[model samples]
Target: MGAKTALLAFTDGDLRPRLLRPVRTNPAELVRVLHPGYEVTPIEDDDLGENTYPPYDTSYVAVLEGAELFCDRRLVFDPPSRLPARVLEAAAGRRVIMHGMHSVSDWLGFAVWENGDLVRSLSLSPDGGGGDNIGTPYEFELPFWAGERPVKAPYPLPFHPLVLGQAALRAFFGFVNEGRPSPDDINPFEVALHGFRVADPTGREQAEREAALQEFLRKVGPPRQYKV
Candidate 1:
């Protein structure tokens, strides 16, 4: 089996009007926008470092002309690329949000960062109506100005219905904002979260991995139709 990979979502530069066109719905167009450079590079397995999981080589770089998306090994969307450029454009030079659904624990978590400072984080559990124990979905809006303040008070309600409590949100921001190294620099969480470790992937983990992926999709909900 190939090495496992974690997904990292970010926008590379300033959000431009031209890049804000709605994401194309055509599969070919979608593939083109998603893999703009079209070069697949081999990522060092060891480079994945400590986090929540092993790192896999970036199989492709997905761009919608505005946003940059990446996947370690598997293509999570139907057309192999789902990020709309507008989304990236909206996040450029500001905050980026990342959401993950963990199948092992049926948990959904999300984090927000602005200029590399952690702003918010959240997580949730299945509500019992979903199929196959898929974890809950998570959603949060990040202002482009998130890093202006050192810490913001917790919200009365979770930004998303699936997100359970304030503690997760606090932890998310703390994990990103507290002067930790980048995931590639050293172990990002090493100094921040002392006992945290990335999970080792194994052959027996396939079933659970698939379930976790499904849960992730369920939480991501549906992609918006591209208008332009």
Candidate 2:
């Protein structure tokens, strides 16, 4: 079993035109390709005013503890901020996984929690074989913060879900079996999902994605072992 819930973060809407859309090859044709459905607005003054850490795009996908989707672009939270009371309460005494795509470096990272305490964090990097090199997933005895309060650290890598899957699973399972946190609190389904998300390819094109991931892991070998 693995983490049942996960949080996914993506690029902000305001910078899409310049980052995702505008063809450096042809700037004048930008507006013509724009579609009403594709429009993404900048963060509002009120929202920006309250934000403490550097601004991040609000787009994210949060898979809740009970296997529900909470997709929104306004779920952004700054570093050092505590998980929402509701989110924390729901995750109380349970394992939760938070995953997000880093647009700046096109990397992905995940935090593993048990009984509301973080146990491990990991990120991957490009190994230059048209694949990724899995970095050592850091195991923590207690929840570690990014800057202030204990939080998971994000890593940089190429933005491919398959590549993210391997790193995420290794972290999740490694923490569950060996980290200081106890899995007795969180649901087993959550743990299973951690493995499933890494191995399953139903939603993604099965053959190609799985093949790429397998090839990558085969090259990288097992994650470096640490003596707890």
Candidate 3:
């Protein structure tokens, strides 16, 4: 299977206008912010290479009791909710991106917050295993979680809800770019393929990679549409 990727983002209240970018953080910093005392082995460049194995190559992992979370590999975790919750806290109310590639998970999901309030969240695994659609965004979900009412979200055209994995990235980054303080938003992110593109395709590999970049940038739909 290809690498398992996920788009985890935290944003300002109202769920729009801007994404909350917390201070710069890393694996060690994540430990302090999310789970202290938990052993964390930082993910180095080699860990992200194609040769890396499944789950391991996908998300950054750390050992936990009865649960070992590959930090970046948010989607593959059994419950899935566990990873995002920690991610939100780690954001501490800033917009951030967790692992964003590989693109595999039993159930793909998304969650957005408005003024620290969870507007809505939904997770669906292919097993027809079901997921949590609780109204509140507080609790990170695991199975056996049945909530009162299921909140709903508007789906973008041409994309099925089940296949929103790539779409999520475009939306968050699109929001991030449109709301950028200045030219910085237009700048490519340090990680992720957001800024990486082939100026001239010498072969099939580079050409295909460039095509993916074009599609990846469509999260905002049209740049002109976002202008006030």
* True lDDT of residue 6, candidate 2: 28
Per-residue lDDT of candidate 1, residues 1-228 (tens digit)? 111223335544432221223244322333334444343333322211243333332333334345533333332221112334443444455555454444444444444455655454443443432222122323322321133322244533223222222223223322221233344232323221111112224433457777898999999998879877
RMSD of 1: 18.5
Q: Candidate 2, after superposition: displacement of residue 118 in Å?
A: 0.8
Tens digit of per-residue lDDT, candidate 3, span 39-106:
34434432212311233223333222221222333233333344546555555664333323333443
lDDT for 204 in candidate 3 is 52
Q: Point to the candidate with the largest lDDT.
A: 3
Residues 48-159 of candidate 2: C-alpha lDDT, one tens digit per residue: 1121112222221222222322222222222213335455454335454444333333444454455655554444334321222223345431122122322144433224
* Candidate 1 C-alpha error for residue 122, in Å: 1.6
* Ranking 2 against 3 by TM-score, winner: 3
In model 3, what is the error at residue 86, expressed in angstroms? 5.7
TM-score, each model?
A: 0.29, 0.28, 0.41
**Candidate that scores best on TM-score:** 3
The full ranking of all candidates by lDDT, starting with the best, is 3, 1, 2
TM-score of 3: 0.41
- Rank by TM-score, highest first: 3, 1, 2
Q: Which stretches of candidate 2 lie over 4 Å from their true place?
A: 1-65, 73-86, 123-162, 165-228
